[model samples]
Target chain A: DQQVKQNSPSLSVQEGRISILNCDYTNSMFDYFLWYKKYPAEGPTFLISISSIKDKNEDGRFTVFLNKSAKHLSLHIVPSQPGDSAVYFCAALPRKTGNQFYFGTGTSLTVIP
Target chain B: DAGITQSPRHKVTETGTPVTLRCHQTENHRYMYWYRQDPGHGLRLIHYSYGVKDTDKGEVSDGYSVSRSKTEDFLLTLESATSSQTSVYFCAISESTTGNTIYFGEGSWLTVV
Candidate 1:
């Protein structure tokens, strides 16, 4: 019954490399997707988002790609830095759900310097 | 960040006892939410309010109740604590229901024994 799923629980990559995180959703009614980053003790912070109408959105070093056909989206960070190491969650805003977002289990990313 | 604060950052309670967690926001956002994060689950919404005394249940609202008597404060109550209810709770605020960014407070960790 998890509408959104992040199959990978964790990932590791070298600093300055491209880090990609993937997410999939089972609900076709979801029209908006967002990414959030969380540190050990702090709450999650907004990263980037993409609408269903757009295939890709980029902000600085963060890029999100959406494929409506596959019900999948991904976040890509180029030149990943040590500071980027954190748990990344993918969430969706279902239409008519009153902005109550559905979030994935999250993927922990580790960047090694 | 977002002027949201979750009180009693950490607490321990015995089973069958009642517990209440407080979330206070200074921004006066129109929307407030309570969510719990577990190991296998990301952030599961417990309840949310659009205005004072206008509250609604979220995906996981059983065994929990929420009250919003004032715009600046939202309270989440666990009528009878259970060991399975031990988790970190987060409070979020947003200005609108859709297409609006939500901000989260540093979570409150509750341990039920």
Candidate 2:
């Protein structure tokens, strides 16, 4: 039983366009959501995060939207650059737990210049 | 980018052999976690420790064990390696204030044949 799911295994987008990655979670107890980016042979780095109290959070070129009603969330990057190409992971933190997290299978994003 | 370090970044072992991976942090974070990443499964939690001598099992703690003797060191041991256990392992640490902002180590790749 996958508590968090990222249906799309991979996505490719043009360098000057927008790239959107989606994720879904089956648990309603999740109160915090975060996005992390990973490159080959490196550890995942924190990108952005949103709390359940809010529906959306933005940081520079990255924006994350949370839809609590649908148990869905998305990460959007504008003016995608070649350097932005990497694996993106969606993680959720349920309130009941002591901030433990659940991660999605991850989506590999490739930006074509 | 914290001072998280993982030793034995790459290892290969035969079935039935025991192997151990070590994660050391210079930041002295109060929380530590061990996660394994497989191709289809994002990052599954193996175990976590809230403080020295305090630990708990995560979602996928079947074949793994963890111990945190001091604030800077946490270890994961595979008593009997198996082919199915071949995957990349990651160690993450976070302070109590920024509990959601988990910092990960470079990761250790283990291939059990």
Candidate 3:
């Protein structure tokens, strides 16, 4: 069974707009959440992360919001740029598992210039 | 950027043939992991190592084996390749002090015919 899931397979946004990518996980033990961005023929790169203790974390134009009660998390990119176009994956790490992360299917984002 | 390297960035192998992928890291991180990315599966953990000789299976450990005789190297082997195994594999490394944030290598694209 997939513990993490991205309900949307893809999203398209205009440049300079806000892009929101969402993720849901079934395991309540997950204490850390992260987002990764992957370009074609390249490895996924870390974007942002949020600890369970905090509801939100931000870095530059990117922010991650976690809702433990709803078992959901969302990654928001403000003033989305064309360079942000890529596949986004959300991953969760369970507290008991030592660095064993569960990843969602991924959402392909297209930032149209 | 994390000093992680994955060998045979691309490979095509015949079914039933043995295939091995190598991951080397210079970061000397205590944790290493192997994950496969499929169309709908996103990325699923195959195996992981916490120490030089300490290894453990992940959610999708079947048909896969791993070895970590050195702190800088983690090897993943497919006993017998199958068409269903055609996907991109990723190697990641992390240290405990970094809150278990893993860094990924470029990736290895494997095509099993």
Candidate 4:
């Protein structure tokens, strides 16, 4: 079963606009959530993460919001740029595991110029 | 790049053939993982090794087998290739930590006709 799910297959937005990617999880034990950005032919790069203890985490132009009550999370990229266009993946890890993670299907965000 | 290297970055094989993908890490990380990426399935873990000779299967481990003879190398073998197995394979390494961050390799693209 897919413990983590990304409902949206893809998203398209213009540069300088805000890009929002969403993810959902069913496992209650997952306490740490992470996001990664991937490009064609390249490995995914870590973007930002949030501890379940908090509701939101922000780093410059990128922000992650977690709603434990809803079992959902979202990544927001404000003023999206062309370079921001890539497949974004959300991963969740349980509090007890030794860092083993479960991943969502991923959402491809296309930031048009 | 996670100090990880996957051999034969791209390969095309025929159904019923046997194929092997090699993942080598220079960092000697204790955790190694194999995942396959597809259009709708993002990244699905096939197998993971916590240490040399210690391994476990993941969600999509049905037709695949893995081995870790050395701390730095993990090998994934397809006993019999099938067209459905065509996808991009990634190898990741993680350091031991209460909350370790996993890193991935460039990925190996495999196609079975």
Q: Which candidate is the best by lDDT?
A: 1
Q: What DockQ does candidate 1 score?
A: 0.78
Question: Which portions of model 4 miss their true places by more than 4 Å?
Answer: none
| Candidate 3: count of backbone clashes, pairs at least 3 residues apart or interchain | 0
lDDT of 2 by residue, A1-113 (tens): 88999999999999999999999999998888899999999999999999999999999999999999999999999989999999999998888577577899999999999
Q: For each predicted model, how many residue pairs clash, with residues at least 3 apart or on different chains?
A: 0, 0, 0, 0
| CAPRI quality band, candidate 3 | medium
TM-score of candidate 3's A chain against the true A chain? 0.98
Q: Which window of 10 residues has the lowest lDDT sum in candidate 1 chain A?
A: A93-102
lDDT for residue B43 in candidate 2, whole number 0-100: 90
CAPRI band for model 1:
medium
Tell me each candidate's TM-score. Answer: 0.97, 0.97, 0.97, 0.96
* lDDT (10s digit) by residue, model 3, range B1-113: 89999998999999999999999999999999999998878999999999999999998899999999999999999999989889999999989833467899999999999
lDDT of 4 by residue, A1-113 (tens): 89999999999999999999999999999998999999999988889999898999999999999999999999999989999999999999889666577999999999999
lDDT of 1 by residue, A1-113 (tens): 89999999999999999999999999999998999999999999999999898999999999999999999999999989999999999999877768788899999999999
Report the C-alpha lDDT of model 1 over B1-113, residue by residue, as the tens digit: 67999999999999999999999999989999999999889989999999999999998999999999999999999999999899999999988766677889999999999
**Which CAPRI quality tier does the interface of model 4 achieve?**
medium
Report how large a share of the reference interface contacts model 3 reproduces: 0.61
Q: Score candidate 2 by lDDT.
A: 0.93
